[model samples]
Target: MTSPLSEPADDVIRAALKAHGGLDRWRNVAYVSADVAFDGVAWNTKTREHPLSHARVTVETGEQRTVLTPFLGADRRSSYSPGLAAVVLADGRVERARSQPRAAFVNDTGETAWDELKLAYFTGFAFWNYLNLPFLVARPGFAVEEVAPVKTSTGTWQRVSYSFPREIATHNRVQAMYFDEEGILQRLDYNSEIFGGQPTAHMLSGYETVDGIQFPTRREIVPRDQDGTPAAGPVLIGMTFTDIEVVNARA
Candidate 1:
């Protein structure tokens, strides 16, 4: 059966599968781990621990990459509180920033990635049937639309843009993604003030094979406008993965 999104030019399904690690490998995957870095600095490390039910995440930053997960029933729907008094949501109901001691959270109503990260898991928004992908996959209202291909340093690829959700999280904005014809995620573009360093645009390319799974090892971030166009003297940042753990079926 052809999906509603199926068309001659819209061969994104076939392209997506082959672009990723392939069907057999994608369906069989359990968990994944990658050493993450930014600006030549080992800023952090990340792990996507997936169970048959839901996925968990452990992100290490600062000096060491720490292993942290939602406190179970505590994190439901659109709120996350991990250890101590860290609270994150798409509605700005809780206060948890170390810097913002008394800044009452202003409810701005839009797409937010900070709240999305609290739930763990990354990408897999459109491809993976929206199951066992990441916390962001279940965000309240994300508008997905297929757009024209945009030229990049790599090559021509199809683009899928996600609009702002009705609710707002700790992070104000969200980054959009670009997928290739083979459905392999090629580039991700977004404007993140919290993570993108400076109001910047980010591009992830150079997909390589590691442990039989196709992963984007090289990522570049540069300052850009709200539309993702690089500014003058665009700074190029890079990241590479050294070790990886692809799901533990026994555990």
Candidate 2:
């Protein structure tokens, strides 16, 4: 095993980690809990919106785990990990479970409405990967490539394309993430395989520091064209995180 510093994309990754907070501070964190309100064209297109209107979400920092409370009802919660997704009682008894949840989305185009279990799987993997960017690139099993710098009104942004290993369930492999010269994340581009390979771009902003970590408070998504430029029309998914707290990692 080689040190991450020796990797090709180390410079950019390290810059991002340092600008957000050192890896040391991130390692001590167990999870991030926040109250988020989700809305946008994505949800509005669904048969019904996810029960996530003003819900609380907790995402594990070191692993691919997430829990969303008040999921469909006030007492039920959705639990997710790389291998499984389930809706469970407050006591954690599984009311439903889907092992190998990613497989369930095989050939799935998220354009159509989804059932309860499908929604659980989608919510789980989506946030689990979304909240763990830039830093997660340094973790094992991800192949990172520093791409060409892009210039925009915001500033000159550095882009890195990340390929996820099989062990992780994510929106798509080879997602390109953009960071400002200051190393803060600004946008992301990828084709959501589950959504039938529709190209999409995530425009991120509204940063707030918690426990010495810089976290994004707002995420806006839009369609992307073949050239990697974001669409100017309707926003796909608009997510805002509030009252975010970084919990200490367990001993």
Candidate 3:
């Protein structure tokens, strides 16, 4: 089938796919599992202060289910699915839950029960989208166009602006990705509507090959200004994934 991405953008995407492992290799995978350590300023919005307890996440790719353990507080698991979100405490009790997206989450008046779980929903889906990158852009309902090159201290980067279909769950419907000469994704730019439409810069580094796929072990997301330059201050979110596992659906 013909790709939606422009010819130049398609070339870059193909190089990225080959660098990561190959579209066919990623397409065959049914699920991927990894233990992740989550921390950053983004979490502060939920707690109203810096967090002390650790957060561990497990994502199911095909099913689109994200399970967050030790979220907000210890021994708590927040499971976010398509239509519903649930939080289970240590004692096996469903502490706080919600059935669907709410209107209140759109406006940032203050945090509420619905807001908390909605954040979980956003995180779950955002991570899933971030983990699956160049290949995901090739999927149906996604459009990609090459943008002007970005010159940095290190080198000039090839850029591409892409958008997700409304049906696809992501932090934002449209975002831009920057790749280095070798086709490794170096940065991602987007305005996260979930976070008040704040411009964000997500950096990918510490690449590790897991099961023949190149995965970024370290990720840092920070606020960016209107000019797409990094904003001053600490990062919004910093995470690292370890203990990676991938299983093919066909297998």
- The number of clashing residue pairs in each candidate reads 9, 0, 0
Runs in model 1 with CA error above 4 Å? 1-14, 22-24, 40-142, 163-174, 181-183, 193-199, 232-238
RMSD of each candidate relative to the true structure: 11.1, 2.7, 3.9
What is candidate 2's CA lDDT for residue 56?
88
lDDT tens readout by residue for model 2, 146-206: 8899999978999988898887788777799899989999999988877787899999999
TM for candidate 2 is 0.92
TM-score, per-candidate, Cα-based:
0.50, 0.92, 0.84
lDDT of 1 by residue, 20-56 (tens): 5554454444445554443421122111132112223
Clashes of 1: 9
Judge candidate 3 against the unseen true structure and give its global Cα lDDT, from 0 to 1: 0.74
lDDT against the true structure, each candidate: 0.40, 0.82, 0.74
What is candidate 1's TM-score against the reference? 0.50
- For residue 246, model 3's alpha carbon misses the true position, in angstroms, by 1.9
Which candidate number has the best TM-score?
A: 2
Candidate 2: C-alpha RMSD after superposition: 2.7
Q: Which stretches of candidate 3 lie over 4 Å from their true place?
A: 1-9, 49-53, 70-76, 88-96, 102-104, 109-116
lDDT ranking from best to worst? 2, 3, 1
Q: What local lDDT does model 1 show for residue 149?
A: 76
